[model samples]
Target: MERIILHCDLNSFYASVELLSHPDLRQTPVAVCGDPTSRHGIILAKNEPAKRFGVQTAETIWQAKKKCPDLVLLPPHHHLYREYSRKVNDIYGQYTDLVEPFGIDESWLDVTGTLHLFGGDARALADTLRRRMRQELGLTLSVGVSFNKVFAKLGSDYKKPDATTVISPENWREIVWPLPVGDLLYVGGAARKLLGQYGVDTIGQLAACKPDMLEQLMGKMGLQLHSYANGLDADPVRSRFEKEPVKSVGNGTTFPQNLTTRDQVRQGIAMLADSVASRLRHLGLYAGGLQVTVRDPQFRDRSRQTRLSAPTHLIREVTETAMDLTEQIWKPPSPIRALTVTAIHLMEAEDTYEQVDLFGGSAATRQRSEKLEAAMDRIRGKYGSSAIAYGAAAPEKEEDPLP
Candidate 1:
């Protein structure tokens, strides 16, 4: 039997959520942005009114303002956005157990087995869900209904706020083929440019390309794109119970200022490593390797990964390892715009045992570190994250602390 999938995307999620509180701005051009003074100034989302003026997401505030001079900029409240995301997903859970979240503002639901309970019409069900969301939560979403996940996502993108588009097997070839090949999933800038060079600019042309020739042009990705264009996607939308296992835990942030000193870099890495380690411990996982990525002011990134001598969930160990890895690819006096630390090669805490070294510290010392970190976690849990710190993560604003 053919599968039934629906992709739902909240329209201008951040800006729309902000408009809920500022109802007067509903018809005004508005955009959600970060503070430019902190070097985080960029458009995160824009409402329909702002979109009409050509405002776009991720562009610098100045760039957006140039197009929409009357644009009203609002600061983001991430906690509020997360609350809405949870509420939206809970509503999705009402219709199917196969609801799968794609991002904070998007989800894919497999209603194949339960559509009958909701009246057995994919387009009707999608429209109903859209109306409920708008009437109850004052938010709008575009929903795509199709026989598979990929087409459902494409369908969702086919329409606008509070709309539904259905792409069935009978109409997909006529409706989806004439669209640009770049409209297909995973066909980003590089792939789209390559396909254009080959005169495979449309989805129809891409679907008719020889698989072997495409493979030679784009390696494995070329074949994947061809399959998508031909409507051959077979990947399942994993339910909550069958969700993919967590492969890595990572944290990153754009700094208020470019980091140019060793102390500044250490501080950034330590802060990120702390979050990654804490998340690993909370998930009951240990990292057997550490990966660090450093982004320069020009937006270029340098990354390095190193295996750990023993799997560990300790903040001290994670921080030290990440700092060491950063040293390999980065040097002092280089302006760094952002930093990320990831705990990779994950294993369940209970399934693995620490590897003790003969030349390393004794078992008693290891146990002490674990207990101390655990105690710190408890303290922060009762108090707040700002209540504790160590080494480069210390909250002292006196001066740079690294040597």
Candidate 2:
């Protein structure tokens, strides 16, 4: 019996979500762009028309405009993307919680357990999802149904716009073999260059090559390359909801001019500790380690972490640890660009609360903080996120804050 993994990728996800918000942009050559002026700013996604003009994603907007002069560009809005992601996940969970998100825009569904209840046909279930996405969300999806993660991911990528393909064991060779060497799942830049040097420019050639030759050229990864080149992958379908995160942390930003100084970065770190504690209480997790990251003016990135003597969920203790770690990360008076704080080595908040000495000020302070956190979570749950936030992240309603 063969296993199954169904890969579903939203076509032009960010662009599609934008089209949802601004119906007028539909059918136009729109591109979801990041700051074109920033070194990291580039095209994130775009409509088909833009792609046809050779406007590749991650290409600078200046380069994009050279390809399609009239291209309309939009900025990335993670918050909006998260909203649609939740909506899509809700839709997918209706089918199976075996669903694992591939990225913000793509997900994998293991419907092996539910295939019988849905009429015993994987293709039909995929088609239903495509149509429903079109009907309900006005979005399109490229779906692949195959025996494993490798072929399923390939199936979605193999399709054209708004299409579905099923790769069965019987037809895997014919349907997959002739594809270009670069299209094989594990064949990256180095592998392609090496395979090209060996005159293996297609999947068929790579698959037909002696296993010894592949092992010699690419080492251990070559074994995986040769296997997936012939359509095979055994990666599991992991549930994002079922598995607790190894870390529970929060971060907040308040960069004036969208950039800031070293002191401001420290304050942001403090705010992040508060936000992280709020989340730790919400998730019932505690942090055993803390790290602070800084992006300097030259785009140089640096980070440092410190382990706590004991895990903690208290805001002050985490903040103090993070600040100490920050000193190790940066020598103040340097040109700082952005800062982020992360909590790591997580344990159940219950574990921390139970393991600590029950008679100390640390325990008393933690108990008080947990109560405060519970209150904040309730308010945010009832109203909305940011219903309660660090004073640094105060809101001024904006028409285009997200765009």
Please provide, for model 1 over 176-279, each residue's C-alpha lDDT reduced to its tens digit, 9 standing for 90 to 100.
Answer: 99998888988887788988998988899999999999999989988888898999999888875575789899999998888877777777887887788778
How high is the lDDT of residue 2 in model 1?
Answer: 96
lDDT of 2 by residue, 46-72 (tens): 998787889898676788899899999
For residue 5, model 1's alpha carbon misses the true position, in angstroms, by: 0.8
Every candidate's lDDT? 0.88, 0.77
Error of 1 at 207 (Å): 6.4
User: Which whole-number lDDT from 0 to 100 does residue 387 have in model 1?
Assistant: 81
Give the TM-score of each candidate: 0.79, 0.63
Q: Give the runs in model 1 whose Cα sits over 4 Å from its true position.
A: 171-244, 298-310, 324-329, 350-372, 378-384, 392-403
Give the winner by lDDT. Answer: 1
Best by TM-score: 1
